[model samples]
Each structure stands twice: as structure tokens, then as C-alpha cells.
Target: MPQRRRNNRVAVSGATGFIGRALSNFLESNGYEVIRLKRQHFKSKKSQLRTLLKGCSVVINLAGAPIAARKWTPNYKKEILNSRINTTGVLVDAIKEMEPKPELFISASAVGIYDSYEVHDEFSTSYATDFLGTVCQAWEAEACKVQRIKDVRLCIVRLGVVLGNEGGAFPKMLRPFKLGLGAKLGDGHQVFPYIHLNDVLNAFWYIIQHETSSGIYNLVAPQMLSNLEITEAIKQRTKKSILPVIPEKILRMLLGEGANALLIGQKVVPDRLEKDGFTFEFPTIEAVLDDLIC
Candidate 1:
């Protein structure tokens, strides 16, 4: 697969998702043709999918169930794991049958792959043993199958808490702050590894532009911040005073295991990305909130 053979055409599996929609627009603005691979496309015959994938230079797999969508019942736990593993499996199987597989296959993972106990880089093996960590591990493992496909390079991005205005965690947090109900989660000591949505779009384009880029990359900002700091940043923008901490017990009770997504987070940094010369547009919580709230 020669570089630029496809004329910058790309296929994305989770086009309807928050990140996916943002990424698609970014790609198109950069003069690349974007193909939205909806859920139905994954369910259809592989031959049909192969048709859609024709001439695509890259295939991005961002298709996964939202980790914090609901309380994690035992069945819902299965839903999280299956949504990631199954969709990646289906996409990989289809790519294998292609006469000329895409030049690159990029998959989405999360910082939750690491346990809350340690600061991690891309090489750390300190994996989390909890359900969220387990799902993230399995998600990357399934995505790794793309490595076996000849001519297809795999790039896995372990994302941090994404902050943006269009959609995602920021908008949800904004409503409470606007209502003067903003409060820190748990003890507010947990590190909130976060990145802006614009940087995410640029990172994908960076991977596409850097043909040699492959393997796992921790997609986070250079600055490390605590949940309390993020709350303070938001408060500065919304002119809301801080409320008392929301006890961990209360979140756990409401979200069950799902509260871990908010109450617990890893201190992850973008070591590999910076080492590769990729720079973030918004590197701190202050910058992120300024862009979204101002």
C-alpha cells in the first residue's frame, strides 16, 4: 500500500459518537474524504463492508459502549466488554478479507487500562484489575489483531477524560455548574488525566501523516491536575462557588461500579506522543475550560 494511494479517503466505525463526529469533520476540513461506518455496517455481510472500505487509507475503530452510560449491572458489564471486543473483532475480520487492507488501523482505548495506584506511560504494565480496566485491556487486545493483517499497521490511543463543549464530559459537567451545584467528586484527590477534543482530532491526523507511527500511545495533556483543580477551573469560568465534596459512597451507591469512572482515574501522561513530536493545542485544564466556557 503506497502512501497517498487512496487520496486521503478514510473509514470510521463509530461516526455517530462524540469523538468520531469531531474527527470526521476534522478530516474533511483537511481535504480527506470521510466514510461513516455505522453500527449496521458492522452487522452486515463482510463483502458489503469491504465495498464501503474501498480506497480508504485508514480505518479508525472508535466503536464502543459508553463506559458510564448506566449502573453496571452484571449484564451491563457484559454489554461493555462485548460492545468493544465484538465490534473490533467484526471490523478486523472484515479487513482481513480485503484485497488490500488499509494502511493503518487506529483503535480507541482509555487510561482506565491502568490501575489508580500508579502514574503510567505507554510501556507500564500496571494494568487495572477492575471491570473498567479489564474491558480496556480486552479492547486493546482485540484491536491488536490488526497487527496480523499484512500491510495494516495498528495504533491504539489510550485516552484521558476528554473535555470539550460540543459534547462529552464537559457539557454534562457544565449544566450542574450553571445551576450553582458544582462540587468535587469524592475526596477531590484523584488525578484527572484529561485532554481537549481538538488535540484528539489532530493526533489522528498526526498518525495518518506520520506513516511510521504505530503501537499504543497515551493521549493526554502534559500538565497533571487533580479533580479539585478541574473543579476550580470550571468554577472560575461559571462564577460558581464550590460546594461540599460529594462522598464516594454516594456516587458508588448511585452508579454502582460505574462511579469508578468519575471517582477514580489514572495519572497518565502522553510520553510517546510528545517524544514523537506531537504537540497538544490545549495542555492544561485552564486552557480547556477557557475555550469551552469563555
Candidate 2:
């Protein structure tokens, strides 16, 4: 591991969200000064953002709506896009104005950017045309604009499902299994790319400390799981009775278009992260669930 940069000032947007909270705490614990950039901070002119971002060595952009929070109404979809794209655009503009800008800009994307059935990696161009995909594409485009600046290095991380005991999909996912209502969804064949929360935090640290790292990375574990495989692992830990498979139609009826984000899946590989030498602490579904489920 590279030596920690204790004196560096780091700025983070979405500092209150699941990933953001973890990242902020990690940075602080490592002796890095963290500046939490709230949504209100970006409301005024680009100058306001530039002032807020000044003197920071690194900036992490993780602001976005929870994709599975609600049914995809047209308005809600707009909220999703605007929240990510607009904020990213403002940040990029601000970075352009900074005299001595942050050295690195780490932004968020999702594996949903890829087409559902295909195997994808950082090099794959097979992208989805759905609402989620469109949102990620635009979000990334705004972040990539920072690349035009010669000094600032930009990294876009396309995250998979992040599992942890404290929050995120793990807690809600564990509920059904704990209630003895555990079952697979939609024949459970869809590939489920996942990474432990620890690895998520570490990936950010790895990128920040390693100045050579940039561009798109799939922040997922080495061993990808099928939905059924993950469900089975959860069941083993919970010792829950295996319930009937939940049909996709029922999920759609219940969750509306939001169900597509859950039911439809992607096989995303962390080709860049692995090739670049970032090792996962929990690399498999069994390892990830074992740590969180117990």
C-alpha cells in the first residue's frame, strides 16, 4: 500500500449517502482533511464551486438518486438524470476555473450502463439504451469533460451492487431471507456483479494514492455471481426455507419500471481494477455474505 497522504485536503460531493459517508470517514481516519460539498454548495455560479473546491487535492463525485428507491415515472427519471449530470457538469466547470485544480476527480457510474445480457468490461462498448443506461452515459460524459484540463486526472468508476452490513442493498436484501421468505428472482439466471463495501472504499483510496490510474473501471469483485448463486449463499447463512421463485411479472407489477433495475442484470468484470493491481478483500458471494450476514 502507498503511504497515506495525511496532509491532503479532499473534497467530496454526496457526502451523506452510503458510499459517500464511508469514503468521508475513511479519509478522515487516514488523516486527510475532508470537505463535504453539499448540494446547496453548487447552486450559485461556477465561481462558488471553484471556491469550494480550491486547495483540495482530490474530489470525489458520488451524487445521484438511489436507483431502486421508486418506480420510474418520467419526472422521477428526470430527477435521476439531473441530479447526476447537472451536479457533475457544475463540478467540471468549477475545476476548469481553479488555478491549481485538484489532481484527481473520481466520479461514479453504474454497471447498468452495460446491456443486460452481455458480458462487459472496461473495454466493452455494449451499452444499454434504457433509462438507467442513458443516465449513466450522460453522467460520465459530464465527468469526462474534466479530462480536457491538462493537469487534472479523471477516473470514472462503474459500480456494481455494493454489499455491507450497515446500509445499502445488503440490509434490505437480508430482510427477506431472515424472514424465511428467501427465494430467487426471475429464474435467478441473471448475472449479479457485486463488491463488498470495504472494497468500494479501498478502490477510491487506491485510485487517489496511485496517480497513474485514470479512466473507466468496473468496481466489482473478481468472482461474479448469478442471482440464484447469491440467493443460495444468503439462504445458507440464514438457514431460511427456500421460498418459491418470484416471477419477473410480479416484480414489475410491484416495482413498476424500477423492477427492471433489479430483475434485469449485467455481467460486469473488474478488468481494469484487477489488471491495475487492486485486490478485493471479499472476492466472492460467499465471502461477501459471510462477512455481512453473520
lDDT of 2 by residue, 1-294 (tens): 566543499999999999999999998998888999998887876777787788998989999888988778888888889999999988888888887888889999999999987789899989999888888998999999999998899999999999888778888889989999878999898888889999999999899998788899999999978899988888988888888798999888877888888888898899998888778899988888778876
Reference-based TM-score of each model: 0.96, 0.96
Candidate 1 residue 286 Cα shift, in angstroms, is 1.0
lDDT of 2 at 53: 82
Number of residue pairs clashing in candidate 1, backbone atoms closer than 3 angstroms, sequence gap of 3 or more or interchain: 0
lDDT tens digits, residue span 132-202, model 1: 88899989999998888888989999999887888888888888889888899999999999999999988
- The alpha-carbon lDDT assigned to residue 268 of candidate 2 equals 89
lDDT of 2 at 273: 88
Q: Clash totals for all models, in order?
A: 0, 0
The lDDT values for all models are: 0.89, 0.88
